[model samples]
Target: MAKKVAHADYHGPSGGWGSVRALGAILRREGNAGSTALALRRQNKHGGFMCVSCAWAKPSPPHVFEFCENGAKATAWDLTSERIDPAFLQRHSVTELEALPDHDLEQAGRLTEPMRWNPVTDRYEPVAWEEAFRHIGQELKALSPDSVVFYASGRPSNEAAYMYQLLARLYGTNNLPDSSNMCHESTSVALPKSLGVPVGTVTLEDFEKADCILIFGQNTASNSPRMLHQLDEAARRGVPIINFNPLRERGLERFINPQNPAQMVATGSKRIASEDHRLRAGGDMAAMVGICRLLLDWDEEARQRGEAPLLDWAFIRAHTHGFEAFADAVRRHDWAAIERRSGLTRGALEGVARHYAAARNTLGIYGMGLTQHRMGVETVQMLVSLLLLRGNIGRAGAGICPVRGHSNVQGQRAVWITEKPELVPLHRLGEMFGFDPPRKKGLDSVEAAGKVISGEVRAVFQLGGNLVRSLPERRLLEPAWRRLRMTVMVTTKLNRSHLVHGEIAYLLPCLSRIEIDRQASGPQTVSMEDSTSCIHASRGIREPASPHLRSEPAIIAGIAKAALPSNPRLDWNAWVGNYDLVRQAIAATYPEWYADYSRRMWEPGGFHRANPAREREWRTETGRANFVAPESLEADPDVRIADGEVLNLITVRSNDQFNTTIYGYDDRFRGIHGSRDVVMMNPEDMQRLGLQATDRVTLIAAVQDGVHRDVQDLQVVPFELPAGCAAGYYPECNPLLPLWHHAKESHVPAAKSIPVRVVRQA
Candidate 1:
């Protein structure tokens, strides 16, 4: 087998001509230059389909080219000319396809029709949509509702997600787990506990007014490129940007705005971060605590001098509770302990604290880096608690921003897509839907995988996303998925999950977001909520890749009708015909929040979902903002390595990849090319471990319990990372992450902070 030539170079800056070249390459490969151009123009624009990329909020007055390089790639990928027809499926066996790469499977192009697994032949044969749904219905009905798990990806529109969750609920199961469980479930759990809201309080316009913004554990350029424009503007306007992460990201260093004519012409690129602190993988919580401790000591000194206090005493007294306890805890945090845990000197943290204290309005930004840890929820709360000390929430230009990845992930949660029945009371949901929803608890992603492995889960159905590629401990999870009685995947393209067959497997082709979705009434439009909670409609402008492909809503509704023939209370078919009716039902479900959802969705810039916390009105048990005061912050207590080199393995997404989907093997931002099978470590650590760059090494999981797994043939790359911390690409390195190693409160797998031992492969 021939592999693409791998290359490495020192990555410097972001955007400029590089972005243009990347976009051009994708468009040329797509071969629909004209249509791809139009799709790119319409993306993130008013009345246009939302970009199937990151959840970055569209500006009120959208830019001429609102899409980024990766966003353009996503659009082109969805609108590719290649198609997986019946002949293609007939030629390839499931076992043969399973051995191929993730990119290869998706590159085979959009699925044209429904496919069913043939055990006798071991190939996926074309099946009618009706027949496929009927078979799934039969399998689902044969088992208990609790025995089936319905997993959803983050790419679906609000209408589709709401309908899918409703279908599961109507079928008497609350086992609704989503991509959020794997990524930012920490934010979804932590924020509401302290700030009375799960979503971020900052608006898109907050960037302009902020004096300083802290970028923690997120590569803004690769993950959310459109944010480079905002970061460039902030840097140019003299706003100090502070970055805290284990690795030195090129985006955090400097960025040239591709939209800027001057920068594109090689005038110069603006530096993004004024101060960059390379904190260890699990050191974020300790770093935050160190900053808080300094702030409190400074406040006490200011009070003794009869000068104005640094703390917002008035706001604290009026709007916050438990400040005294929190302050006491901060004062008690030992500088030595904080320094040891954070891998930063006390003076360095104090210097950063001074800058934090000087800024009138500061925005704290983070991503999966902070959330994919054992102390993820607590880490988020510490940042929130820091903001509360200065009365940042509800204020102009200052608040918390988790920086979600999916387009409608936040919206899906708002509409109630979770396993917990208490989130939205069953009685209230029953009154709106006219059917009593199941009250029993449901399994999360990890627990669901465990059930599947235990042979307790009879069936597993995925709306989107690659379960085999996204979940942790794939070596175990994949075999468990194979043992299922039935497996169904509703997707636009073939992925690794499609190859993992059960006793009975079905693949239902669905229309991509860039494709036209026509139903019984007329062409339909779906809505998605961005990171800022702005709800808008997404109407595909181009013709669909395949005529046989059905829209996601239509497929979900079809499955609902087939699965629940006895209950005629909900008209699933009629509702699917007109998505407006779905929105109307959503409005009826949450009359107070979504009173006129259908009308509001069509508004020019869309409408912002009402959040009382954003307006300074706390809805907690105390009827005010709460503060959590912990004694210490430590992530992994079981990481004991006395002999070999122990590295804190942090899983990261490559520049060309989005979650589990691999666009290409090149990660331009990190200087890694044509390969993700490598580990990045600090030069000092590499020297200490007697390893050289490009040396083959095997990474063994250093877990206290559970099955230990090892990833071999990983090339070592000495990059500018913190000592004792090594970075590896996700899905491949997911096997090293123990399933049981997760956050206590949120139950999110600790993908970012896996303790591992690195040794040269013999």
Candidate 2:
């Protein structure tokens, strides 16, 4: 039977009444409409909880309603009065729960207590907190230190993340991998090599002063709606916003600020992007090189005419390195190859370059589209190279902004939840904690999964994320996960990860970000670092979902205390009882960035961490920003099809989804409703394949892995995509993404581009 799919060309603006209605719908659905106004008003405000959505920066004096529709949804999702107690678990077996859809599993409601898998009954049974911790500790003690993987999500507060990593290190291993490895690890890896900073150099204020904004491969509307406000304001100020992505997203084209009463009532919208270039999937590198090539050509022409050079020659000569080699590489890039790969004409790229050259200061903003490809690191470096051509870096209102996903994903890294051993200050940590931390580098997400599959990793510890669902190769990982000796998950809500249990799996319910965390010291406040490097306080105003739920810090502390009973130097109890102690320890460990952390967090807009690149103080090996050239113009060189007909598949997140968590089945902005199992193909590609809207098809991954990686029963919908390219929602289509198909250095799954052949389903 054909799935019930709703299709229409959405003519409304990005936000406005649509967003208002969506927010109301979510609130009503969650049965939290009574406290909606209070919860929303406090979101993103000083002394209130941070929006658990994207890592977009909060203004110093935030708006009256500082939250977006998605942010509100997240709040409502967390604050839902629904509960998943012992009876709920008793009603559903693990196997039966595993069969449920991802959305249905989460929608069952928030977990109320710690539960342990009872293999005898195939259901999770309520377990005492102490007993659960003791068993988890025993399981860890039985395994080798390197056999356990401590994984963290982006949801944890700075204190929780710090303690989580500390717990891993105390357990005598450096095997700490977190959500960043999957999302923006490319940026974290590439930025330091190019700009001497892992994070972006720009602040929220930079958007106000930017003359030109270049957005690459990011759907600002769906991924981070708060960013739309910044883009809308920039557009209103006549800033030339150029967007480069396969889809001409409504958020980039136009937005109606729901906060603006007049605009909402009038049903009027403001133009966002001055130009939207629909590039092919995984073509960011080629498009960027083309723009750089044009800029260099213009500079050469200007120099020949005895006019002022278009490039920032003085800045390049003083503050950067490898300009000659980078320029030579750009000049040698074939224009035809660039055009073919980017699916853009020379004239179009030249126009964008012209706008870039005309602007004194430009902000380069990108998302997973540029970071989840095989050449993600090189692509990010190429963007840095583009900014280097005009001295965009280290200048006011100009820099590379990798819009991060989670509110505290950047914070987790800042507090040292990394697989790289050298990134953390081991010597300082030892002095502070009186324990010799592990020096060996650990496995990233991909390596960790491989280890799990190989039976090398016996246990997995997750901090608030659906690791199994978020990762690629769900088929391989999920079964391998069940074979593990132990799996511990500290989360607020029920997810697929809980159902896919190990031999001795434990589900530890923890307090959500919006709940009051009353510790021995009093009602505690957790701090999170925004994408802009501003560390601020997030105080939960709502009541806890259940009395049994503990704060993330408390859960981590309990586990660490049970695991490392003799470690007297590290006061796990003190840290949990008083979060200020965690901040003090964090301040001591990384004094350069977090000194006086607690006091600074209370500042009007929080405190911005010191980014050496912003001051032109290069921390690279060469002591300067490096213009690294990519080896090839193709972002995914291995993405080829030797078969009859193939399309480059780009996995996307719908407006109703956040990472692996599905809020609803509707993608309103794209006009997709009542279904997520659909592939969006270009009109010409659909015709070429003899397919039409709602035509059922199966996408077979074009790989040499011998294993069949395919997603069947995907309905086709015609979209304005480039030829030979199709888009599908992520995780649903994640089966087509092989575990081996990841970025070269960063190991981030190349989910943005997959070579696949589509066969119409009869």
Candidate 3:
């Protein structure tokens, strides 16, 4: 039924000579081959710029070369010599530029000055900073505050995020949606209800003490490469690492530390996982339920045998509620149903349970794989329930770790960049800032897009992100974006969002993380919080790309001054002149966590924010951690299909990509080269569908929305995946995801699993 072809597989270990070669190539491509070495040495170190890559933690006593290959790419991307001046903007029309690919659009270089769209000429022309601010002010004054949306990427510093939120609140709106709304909003919503904390409880040091590590739906090699070192060390110490995912990611299989010369040159590599379980996409919840059922059964057997019970009864009685109800719900789930939903046999799930029960302290780490589904909230709660069975919370080397993608995404939420007003301290903000903040719930990413389509939202203020490319249903959102009355983007480089501009769109160039941000006082330092809740100082070592570029704080202040009425209570100029004033305000607002912020920021490795869950102090309504249960074994019952030709599609990112930003065409780890327009499928499924390797096909969504959503001209590649399951690159496959298909509670787009039918091209 199928035609056979030669398979291209990568046999090398992760982070060996391949990574070194990739880094060298990126440096040369960006024309930073000479000065990049010094920059790499200073990255993630004290008194140096933080890596603008992932939110992986840094060691206290940092290594000389603490950065990874992707980190090198990000730095080179920021420090590239290419510049987009007025002449460059004038040379190409908006229609002409929109035809270029995303990578080429970004490669056009960094913005050199403020520019405004000229509808008459269909091109962007340079404008003065003062004039741009005045026009933005006038436009804002004309529209209702509720009709404007303020969106931020995860790249902004804590001080900038705090000021940006303050500006929005002072303008009488709570519409502060951010990057977190798209990625980790499920974690934010589920963790607080389950653990009494919205963030992870474990620190970087926990890896050393963890007896067993359970990773779900995360690719360390591609998403967070710096975490490989911790896994390598844990494996060397004989810790059991049980990984659960549909794909056997290279990072979780074996790792060769580039920092270790002996390991790099050796033929062998360090084994990272003790066992890798291939579960179906969107089956994380089912697998968790299966493991919990086995643990409950084992506990009963141990109790009947007059031995110690497997579950932590003491911890459960003391620090948790609703355990009995959760256990009862687990008992109701049948093995046949679990196996059918999870695509895992009972024996495999038993092995996972055995590993989890054998260890005294276990750690659970997850990413978007679990959170980008329809039942994302319930799935996260199930994982928390699995950990609570053994009292994993608040224990050394044991807790939940939600590996965030952006460096300061969690920190942005910490500084009140959220739609839910109750999560922030409104009373304190009002008393300190001398204004009453809005109480109405604001719009999230999905809600904002829907409102934009309906002509409810008239303006958009983007801090720093390619919002057009990142959100789902790009085919619909891109055209609706142009309907806005005004759009202002404060960014470092050009992106697809710039081309899909509004009637009155303005682009304001700003300093990046690796560039100097000097104020009237002296050289200023910005703070970022890692995924581990560790906040540290980051200072730039390179000069600004353009002399006209301003810092994020300055740009926000300029707009605030021009838009709102003069307020004696707030000093915008002083905050911009000395960043310490902004830090002081942050310390005053969140005294319990950020008191003496400036002094603590200068510490060796900075300081960890206080988490009540880590201290066994429950902040939930019941005054204890809660054990929540899912209603069924199926994660997405509404979209489940029984048809043989229909497959569950999981949108993935390439090794050369981060979020929506594409660095190169090669995913060296997956053996994909020259293009990202391919779909990976199981060989058996290809044969069943009468398809072969290199066959051209189109993926059509199986939804009943009456809208035909399909991605055409995708080459099918046979890979190691479960039957009836397929994988495709994200943002490319994002078109097949309906705007209405999102998590029930969190509103995050369900990009991980979409039911699709593959139609062969003639």
lDDT of each: 0.85, 0.90, 0.90
State the lDDT of candidate 1 residue by residue for 436-476, as single tens digits.
Answer: 78988888888887888788998988988888888887888
Per-residue lDDT for 437 in model 1?
Answer: 85
Candidate ordering by TM-score (highest first)? 2, 3, 1
CA lDDT, candidate 3, residue 396: 90
Native-referenced Cα lDDT, model 1: 0.85
Candidate 3 deviant stretches above 4 angstroms? 1-7
Judged by whole-model lDDT over C-alpha atoms, candidate 3 comes out at 0.90
Residue 39 lDDT in candidate 2: 83
Alpha-carbon RMSD, each predicted model:
1.5, 1.0, 2.0
Weakest 10 consecutive residues of candidate 2 by summed lDDT: 636-645
Clashing pairs in model 1? none
TM-score of 1: 0.98
Worst 10 residues of 1 by lDDT: 1-10
lDDT per residue, candidate 3, 470-535, as tens digits?
A: 887777888889999999999988898988988999999999989899999888999989999999
Give residue 4's error in model 3 in angstroms.
18
